[model samples]
Target: MSEETVRSAKGRMGSFSFEGESAEGLLRIGEVTKSTGLTARTLRYWEEIGLISPIDHIENRERRYSGKVLERIDVIRRLQEVLGLSLAEVKAVLEQEDRLLEVVSRYRKDLDSGTRLVMLTEAKRANDEIVKRLDDRLSEIGRFRMERVERGQRIDSAIEQILREAND
Candidate 1:
């Protein structure tokens, strides 16, 4: 082949790429297979299993994948290869992960607000009890003082009567 014809054939076969024509992250099924090192059949099987979903569709009915799909693929790959988890177990784990995070967030909020309320209530109750006890003790002391004063008056009146009789 001539030099120019060979170069044109290579360019047609995607050997040479311009800036705008290169689809790196925005990949269709073939590119996704190449980038992920996964077979097209495996990708379709994973989709069938509900492990990952395509991000969008092209005008020609091609599925377009995004970075999110790539991340999910990585997770699925790890779960299968490294963790030795079955597809069902991986799906269940992912679902449980979301639920656990939600529950933890709610518990944290409840702990913060409920703990503050409980502490405030306990402190107020303690203060109220202390004030009530002090009031009762003060009232008892007042009654005891009044009774002693009345008894002293009676003794002084008796002494006065005795002195008047002596003088008469």
Candidate 2:
């Protein structure tokens, strides 16, 4: 059986089917770009780069995003705007985050308990990697912010001294 067929047997066939929301609430690329504040070209490029899964395409070749996947997009946006991570870093972080879902969906209780244990262990490892990456990124951001603050203060002090000298 094909991967899609096997996934369908497990009740989902795609990456975005969380809490049953992917079955409905789909948005076209236009709507997604508008709502996510991303350009259409950027979205397409991200998909092309494997940074994001390409959103669904219909018979006419227009693409629609799974609304459930909007949450994932938010994470991408935050990583882009806030953390300033490179595309490669963002992809690595996202892959780790998405790994648990992919692993857990493979579980079948009817199979040996050992299989379930393996899946659970894999999930934990993925979660740990995600957490570690996030923590490191946060610390890096903190240092960046402090450097910016120091620069601003220096600029302000220099301007204030010029004004004081001019008044005297």
Q: List clash counts for every candidate, in order.
A: 0, 0
TM-score of each: 0.43, 0.66
Q: What is the lDDT of candidate 2?
A: 0.74
lDDT of 2 at 52: 68
Instruction: Give the per-residue lDDT of model 1 (tens digit) for 1-168.
Output: 234433443444443223343333445677668667899898888887878776655467766554456777887787668555678867765555445445555555665777756655655554555455446556866798899999999999999999999999
Best by TM-score: 2
Regions of model 2 farther than 4 Å from truth = 1-24, 58-60, 108-111, 145-168
lDDT tens digits, residues 1-168, model 2? Answer: 234333442353334543344534556576667667789999889888887664556567667566545677888888878788888888998888778878877875337788888898999999999888879999988998999999999999999999999999
